[model samples]
Target chain A: MPIDIDISHVARLARLALDDDQLELYRRQLGVILEHAARVQALDTEGVEPTGHPLGFTNAFRDDEVRPSLDREVVLAEAPEERDGYFVVPPALEGP
Target chain B: MSLADLTITEAARGLRERRFSSRELVDAVLERAAQTEAELHAYLTLDHEGARRAADQADEELASGTDRGPLHGIPIALKDNLCTSGVETTCASQILAGYHPPYDATAVRRLREAGAVPVGKTNLDEFAMGSSTENSAYGPTRNPWDPDRVPGGSSGGSAAAVAAGSALGALGSDTGGSIRQPASLCGLVGVKPTYGLVSRYGLVAFASSLDQIGPLARTVEDAIAILEAIAGHDPADATSWAGEVPDFRAELGRGVEGLRIGTVTELSGDGYEPAVSEAVASMVAELEARGARVEEVSLPTFDVALSAYYLIAPAEASANLARFDGVRYGLRVPGATTEEMMARTRAEGFGPEVIRRILLGTYALSAGYYDAFYGQAHRVRTLIARDFARAYERVDVLVSPTSPTVAFPIGERTEDPLAMYLSDICTIPSNLAGHPAISIPIGLDDAGLPIGFQVMAPALAEPLLFRVAAEVERIAGFDARPTGVAP
Candidate 1:
């Protein structure tokens, strides 16, 4: 069965800005890939539990203790923009 | 012999015998890297000053009788995705331009502790997303065996560096054949150890569950040395196995005698190149003659592995890459709002392949499609693991062609994303199963390009895996070197 995907909507969800050319290209390409991936739908996976990790190790707990971490100055130095030792970014809400 | 061409085992021996100083070995490799840079494009950032300083320290330690281990004083390359402190560790993506890591990845730190001199960071697909290094923002790494062909990638640069004698051995992360496929293409040994055997603390995650950092080397023993130096539990990575890491080097001479080797019935014949299938057949024949029992085992679930991988890996990638939303530690594109800034930054920073996968992943994990795509893929993953478990009950190890085909022409599959994805068909199953696998060069093709025979073992079977690989390495006696690149 062929699947219908809204490439633009998906790109929005992925936080990507795709131009017209890239959008068309990815639509065609991803269509083919997902079509092939449709084979997974045919497998009798009923009653088989999903595997999130190959090793199947769960709840990798450790002692909750403070450990030395990367220095603030060093970590902030790699940021694109920083002020007051914190990363700077555009506002989350629209301006008044 | 040029010191650059020595395997880690041989190089370590030379250092101990005082045949060459660490400085001399580093200089020889640095010079070779310079000679091959224009043709191979193997390295993205060469740590000349750092490598020299490390070499001098190694020499001083040796002079004072402080031995660090097998990797001490050896020069090697790292796939750029593995973080190195103070070095611009780009995952061959523009997004990470000018970004220097604050700390060394666990594997890199372990290598440093072992006294291994890191010559440089090798190129790879952006975020280790593609099968070929062509997806790198830098440039594709050419195969040393045939310059017109690609060095099979995301680990292409590391494979080429080792093959060209620019580095004795290198570390490459294998999410889905990133290490093994390239090693096959470049005529080297590549190991993708059991999933948790090596910590993922600092590896740029493609699919956290599937990714593993392993060694690509000229010889099996050299690969063992690197694997041992890097393997062990790390508290920093919670998923890291807490079990003991065995002495992999001790398993080298055990041979494959009395080993049960099963050739996966579904992995060969159809899409595989004739030479590749023949090489695997010949390897099984040699092992059988040497007293190993060979049989055919069917893992029918492997047929859907590629499809399952395409979905599951991308779904994980979409989540892992959300951390790269600009404003912190990488390139940031300006926009009116934060979300807009992220969109613009990702649009400009990522390459075509990365963008495509991100979109695919988002779609797979989207509200309605989750159960059909991502959920079903995980179920398939479960089946694939079950198949491996069942097969291991019958066989001590499994054999297959490392790749369906050899290193292809640089531009041949670039246009077809699906075609590029197909390149990793044979090597993806082991990743999905979370089993340990190794690819060793068995012979050359009719065109003189190398063919690889892969042997996969159950989880934590490194010792057994190395034993079979060593026996095959001895039996095949594949000593042919690439003469095309003038190494």
Candidate 2:
């Protein structure tokens, strides 16, 4: 399958503020990656089950038990911003 | 006082003999870490004070005749993704730059219970995203062998810390050869235990099913020692295995006599540097001479292993990383709307490689592409797994070159990501098969860089894995000393 990737798509998806030079550089690099990924797409896996892990371990579960929390003051000690001991969320709207 | 060169078992023995106080050892390692942290950039944090308290407490308990097994009072490090209560657990990304968990990762709790002192967290690829430490938000961990070269990653920091003698051992996460490849490049002994061997309860997700936490050390015994401390079923992780965790060190000294060794016929083929191939051949010869029968075997599906890996790894990563979107715990971006906030935060928080993977993985699993991409890849994974199972039936262990080549320059393959991804070619199948694999430094290339010997076994076959790796380490004379330390 062909990819319609140019530097702009990469820049937008990657959220990088790339200049023209970086765009070209990243364009070529991303192309190599996609091309290689294309090669991986060519294998024949007709009847095989997709193996996510080699060994299978079913999810281990623990009953939800409320535990004592870390010292709120100590927990918030590293916070860049806090309000009433809860992590302060960013204002929902951008400033006008 | 040079605990840097001592295996974890040896260090514990000395501590037990009261030869050196745990505080003294911790101080030594902490000092080396402080001195080299800037140059090597191996650590994300240095808990010199916290580690000292743990060591002093260990000494008090030891003097009272208590032993915490191998890791007790041993100073170690971890890739920051392994959460520890009261310690900053950044996953090497700006997204969680200062995130500290209220609970310890299951592995960390086990290590602490074993009397291990966590000196600090090591750096890694952002969310364990890249093949090089260069993707770490803090800074790249430099190769101790060649400062100009990178410590192979996504577990690069753990490998770097061990290689530079910064810590006695470290815990690293492996999904897609993270532990083994970095260990190979950094010349440390690293083992990614069979999928559920060690609990992954506190490890930040990369690819949930594929991610595993394991030990990285200077010697096979050290890796085994740490493994003993952490391998067990944990109620917190549903996937934790039910079997008994074997005493890895106990399986050593058998010398691989009469052992059935399978050599991957294709891995030793082309695409490897001549030096790496020679090292594999020389090491294989040593195994054969040591009374072991080594024969060539094939995993025809192996050729397609990497292809399946790319599709599967990223596809899972895309789903796993979705939880990081400006949530309650991590850094949040303020935008006019939630949609804008999501994009801004992910863009600002994730590194370039991370974004690329999220998109690639997301694309693969997205509508209209699932079958051709993820679905097809999942089926390939089954073939690869079956190939391993069949190969294991014929051979006790499978041996291969851990990596295709030795450590390259810092930015040599970053510009060409595919070239970099191909480095994990030999190691990825083990991950796909969810098998136990170990990498020990075999020899070096002409450039004096390390070449790793990889030994993999059927599921939960750590006993077999340790046996072969230790024998190879013994005959190959692959010591843990830093390259120039012989002087």
DockQ of each: 0.90, 0.37
Candidate topping lDDT: 1
Looking at model 2 chain B, which ten-residue stretch has the lowest summed lDDT?
Answer: B478-487
Regions more than 4 Å wrong, model 1: none
lDDT of candidate 1 over B1-487, digit per residue (tens) = 6898888888899999999999999999999988888999999999999999999999999999999999999998999999999999889999998889999999999999999999999999899988879999988889999999999998999999999999999999999999999999999999999989999888988899899999999999999889988999999888899988877866778787888999999998778888888888988998999899999999999999999999999999999999998978799999989999999999999998998899899999999999999999999999999999999999999999999998899999999988999999999999998999999998898898999989999998888999999999999888777776875
The residue-by-residue lDDT of candidate 2 on A1-96, one tens digit each, is 346454465345433344567456545554555566665567766666655545654354567899875688876766555789786655556678
For candidate 1, the TM-score is 0.99
Cα lDDT tens digits, model 1, A1-96, are: 556778889999999988888888898889999999989999998899999768889878878899988899999999889999889999989968
Give the TM-score of each candidate.
0.99, 0.92
Tell me the tens digit of each residue's lDDT in model 2 across B1-487: 3666667778889998888988988887877776677778889988877999999999999999898787888989888999988788889999897787878999999899989999999999899977778888887888888888888999999998888777889999999889999999988899999988899888999988789999999888888888888999886777888778776766778888899898898797678989999999988988899888988999888887787788788878777777776645677777666556666787778877887777677666666768887888778778888888888788899898999888878889876667778888888888888888999898878788999999999887788788888889889897645663211
Inter-residue clash pairs, candidate 1: none
Q: What is the lDDT of candidate 1?
A: 0.92
lDDT of each: 0.92, 0.81
